[model samples]
Target: MRYWLYKSEPATWSWDQQKEKGAAGEEWTGVRNYQARNFMREMSVGDRGFFYHSNEGKEIVGIVEVVKEAHPDSTADDAKWECVDIKAVMDVPKPVSLEQVKAEPKLKDMVLVNNSRLSVQPVTEAEFAYVCELAGVDPEKAMKG
Candidate 1:
C-alpha cells in the first residue's frame, strides 16, 4: 500500500478527536486544495498515513489507516473534492516534531520538509519507516495495531 502524511490544525482536528472516532473512522473532509484532493483520490483502503498536528504541535503525533477509499466530501459545497475514512492506528511513542524532521538529513527530500504547506502529502516508504523509527515506534507493529 502507499503511504501518506495528512495534516490538521490540532485546534480544528486533533489526534484525540480521531481516536475518539475509533473503528468507525472519520471522514477526512474539507480539503480544498486540488493537489491534496488528488492525493486522497489515490488512496486505497489499508494505506497508512501519519496524522500530523500542524499549527499547534507541528508534529507527527499518530498513525491512521485508510478504511474507506475516496468518496464525495460531505463537508464540501461543490462536487470538486473527495475524502476518505481513516481510523487512528496508534500514537507515536515519541512525537516527531517538525524541527526534528527538518534536522534529519535522511528526511531532506521529504515533501513535508520541502513543501510544508501541503496539507495532504505523499511519503516514501523509507521516509515513513525512518520517521516511525525516530518517534520510537516500530513501523510494522504500528501498522498491525
Candidate 2:
C-alpha cells in the first residue's frame, strides 16, 4: 500500500483527538492547496499515513489508516474539494521530531525535510519504514491491514 504524511496543528487537531474518534475515523478536511488535495484524492482505504503534529509538536506522533477513499469534503462549499477518512492506528513508541528527521543521513531525501510546509505529502516506503524504526514502532506490524 502507498504511504503518506498528513500534517495538522495540535491546537486544531491533536493526535489525542484523532485517537478519540475511534474506528469510525474522521474526514480530513479544510485542505485548500491543490497539491494537498491531490494527495488526498490519491489515497486509498488501507493505506498508511504518518500523523504529524505540526506547529506545536513538529513531530510524527502517530500512525493512521485510510479507512475511506477520497470524496467530496463535507466541510467545503465547493465540490472540487475532496477529503479522506482516517482512523488512528497507534501512537509512535517514540515521537520522531523534525530535527531528528533532518539529522538522519538516511532521511536526507525525505519530502518532509525538503518541503516542510506541505500539509499532505507522499512518502516513499523506505522513508516510511525508517520513520517507523526511529519511532520505535515495527514497520511490518504497523503496515499490516
For 57-142, candidate 1 gives per-residue lDDT tens digits of 89999999999999999998899889999999999889999999999999999999999999999999999989999999987876
List where candidate 2 sits over 4 angstroms from the true fold: none
Number of colliding residue pairs in model 2: 0
Report lDDT per candidate: 0.94, 0.95
Local distance difference test, candidate 2 = 0.95
Model 1 residue 137 CA deviation (Å) reads 0.6
The best candidate in terms of lDDT = 2
After aligning candidate 2 to the native by TM-score, how far in Å is the CA of 143 from where it should be?
1.2
TM-score of each: 0.97, 0.98
